[model samples]
Target: MIVATVQGNEKGGKHITVKDGVKIFGKEQQEYINNIYDKFHINRIEIIGDFGIKKIKSKEWFCYMKHPEVDASGRTGIAFIVWDKNTEDDTIEKTIREIGFRDEDYIKFNKEYNKIKKGKSNKKKQLIFLVGLGMGLAAGLIVITLSMIKK
Candidate 1:
């Protein structure tokens, strides 16, 4: 079992240790995380990417968890130590993408992936694309307006 640590920070900025040794029984690591959060009682959790030797400061390679209900004082913060048996980095990345997380949506993906994974829902993914489209349209209009003014 490959073990990963999930740390949680409380409202007071204190660190709270939740549960460790959280195991992923099957192939789908992300899906497993989602199910754990959904079925179990957790305040908040997130998957953080680790930038090993490459030192990549992005969410493309690591997983983590956080809980808001547990705190540093042992009151409202929880940490879930997850286990993954698969060691293939490519497979993990592929799974993330298939779940609707774009290469750029790593962080946001971590935040919302659980919702879809647990409930088997896709509402959040649709909203993300819709928001992206709206932003693109606004930018296009601004560019066109500026060009007309210059003319």
Candidate 2:
């Protein structure tokens, strides 16, 4: 579940190819990957390389690249990549579609994850209720036996 977003604040350097983007980013690229690791609890993440390098080392992985930053003419834009190996594709797609990358992505992912977790929570609640009911029944049975013995 490696999700990363990078922005080049340099003026007139907005739109660029991934290869050119990596060059423009330079050390910042690694910093971005590191930041993603720090930000998310993903299974694994590794940078294949820059400049037309598409070598992936993971067996199950997904990548989403999008450009939300664009000029009026839509000619210039900044692109970011979100990579993940362990997370579900639907989860990733929903997150990207609903909130996009960067801070927005984080918030949306948390929200969606919580929603998906609701099913498990219901099951937990049912288990807790059953345990409590069994305990109460046993306590009642013990009280009845003790009272009957006294009688």
**Which pairs clash in model 2?**
none
Query: Per-residue lDDT tens digits of candidate 2, residues 65-128?
Result: 3434544555423233444446565655544443334565445445654554576579889999
Best by lDDT: 2
- Would you give me the overall lDDT of model 2? 0.46
Candidate 2 deviant stretches above 4 angstroms: 1-95, 98-115
Against the reference, the lDDT scores of all candidates come to 0.41, 0.46
* Strongest candidate by TM-score: 2
TM-score of each prediction: 0.24, 0.34
lDDT of 1 by residue, 14-108 (tens): 22221222233334545545644552334233334322111012222234333234445675323333324333444444443433334664455
